[model samples]
Target: MIQRAETEHSKELGCAKHLLLAIGSANVIGVSLPASLSSHAGPGAGQGRSVFFSDGVSRIRLTLDENSPVLIENSGETAVLTFDGPGGLISVEGFVEKTGCHCPKQAYITINEGCIFSCRYCNVPNLDKHIKTPDEIASLISDAVRRENVECISLTSGVVGTMQEEDERLFAILERVRPFGLPIGVSVYPTPGLSQRLFELGVSEVKFNLETATGKLFAEMCPSLDRDVLCNALKEAVGIFGKNRVYTNIILGLGESKAEMKQCITHCLENGVIPIIRPLTPSAQLSHFSRPLAEDILSISEFLQSELLRFGLDPSASKTMCAKCMGCDLTPMTDLHLGEVTP
Candidate 1:
């Protein structure tokens, strides 16, 4: 019985492996693989070897063979898999950074539970909660920034009452935090004439997440949102914050195509907005979505790095550019190029 259970477990692992691969492929190519192929026979001898190239500098090799088991190797270490069968071949490269930003002491304060639009993937519970007092929110920001290296603060609130009321509360919070001179970022649902108001309040950056690339998907996923409103807000943000200051978060593994992804990136770039790509992690209360494979993440990162290079942006320049840049951009420049702002 033990042997039989082990065999069944191996099959289940195989199914999981294929499911991951299928989801990854579908995310990249925008098509689902057939169930039969997604659950094809287990990895056998000579059938599973994968190479990952990151930023054309780092290489990772993974090998899976019947008797040899699985072996994964990076620049400095090698890990051997003892149990699971071989997984298939996958390769990805681009967008490797040596370091990341120091996240500031930040807190997300949800003021209201009332949102005008309902998005399918949102994790927020109901939209009818009471608004937290501006003084309370401001106190939280002060405490966070006082702790350690907190250079920026992000303030996010729900849309409740009138648009003017939301604006008033947001402005009040900003007013209280302004004394610290710390950069502030906010997530706002696009409303007519709202971007300018937020920018005028000394918000360093604003995020109006597009969520999905295709309009059809947007309609399906965010039934209550008006796409045109969101687009206009993004456009206005570019005008207000300058292209480099405006950022949009894009979640991968939402059944978007590589072509669509590229198009979205290109659009954001031209408009002076940066695309912040992150994988979708499943939540028990939400949908059971799978994250894109490692290769896909690496590939998207690489593409972003290349594009940033074109714009004269280096990965190490400024963490204030979303806390990714440390103090590297502040050092004295012996031969600095004109029009380049380090950090």
Candidate 2:
């Protein structure tokens, strides 16, 4: 019985690795015939027009007949299928308002959809800009909670004009949704004294993405921001939000070597911030870099899982955001409590 269970667990992990590869690949392996998605739950239950998929052990909500950045291929009746996307498969409950952000576990919303910075890998500036009012977004939060089982909320926005202006808007939205009691995570540019300010505003989590792992890569991929400023801000974040509560996103395919990746992860661990390693998802004009190899992410994830444990940090202990979501990457923090992965 023990041997059988071990074999089963290995099979599941192997399948997960394959899924990660498909999800993290940049080029499409095959074209899928388009189909129309019909709701299969609630008012649309029993309708064959919808399909469900599980990323690792996480149940994902998906529409059958639509084109998502994450594409499903060779789908069988059991929904045991492979999905392709630059980023690993995430729990996309659906779009919020009209931004490209995916609400994996709970809610991922964009305060506005235009960026002022010119990051080499982001296509946000190439698209049409969108803005939302505080009340409109508050209504969105209410609807998301009412209509869906949205547990927490993550917010992102382009640098509308100035960092201060964007911060004001974010604070306003927080005021409107503060009464909901949902754990809120915000991803924004770090301004002077902003972490403490946001922390005081009841923001539960925050991410200021140092997308590139090293200063050299930062200059090559994203020259708009000062790398030192972001790094300094992360230290402040750890001080204010505590370890593992503060986070940053590091995309894997931006010319960062394994050594660079290790250094980056170590830096984050040393500073008490959890680095969310992401694949360089291709889209818009930013589709040049190849998708990261899944094995690389898996290797790093295994290291990070151990690193987190070493630091007395636990992703599962996080209150909100990507560590809690664990959808976009192969981080093993999501798998620590499982029953030996028997299934």
**lDDT at residue 150 of model 1 (Cα atoms):** 63
For model 2, the superposed segments whose C-alpha errors exceed 4 Å read 1-22, 25-52, 59-78, 82-101, 284-286, 335-343
lDDT per residue for candidate 2 within 1-343, as digits (tens), equals: 0011211122232235424433432111233323323311111122224333344454323334344344444333222333332343322221111111243345567777767777777766654677878988887777677766677877777776877788899889888888888888888888889899889999888888898889998997777889899999999988898765888888877787888988898888888888877766554445655666666766777777677766666666666666665545555546433222121
- Runs off by more than 4 Å, candidate 1: 1-104, 113-116, 126-130, 284-286, 311-343
Candidate 1 structure quality by residue, lDDT tens digits, 225-342 = 7777777789888788774667666766677887887788777766776766645543322366665664665466556656655654442332243223211111111111123334
* Candidate 1 lDDT score at position 154: 64
Provide the lDDT at 342 for model 1: 42
The lDDT for every candidate, in the order shown, is 0.49, 0.62
Measured over all alpha carbons after superposition, the RMSD of each candidate to the real structure, in angstroms, is 13.5, 8.8
TM-score of 2: 0.76
TM-score of each: 0.61, 0.76
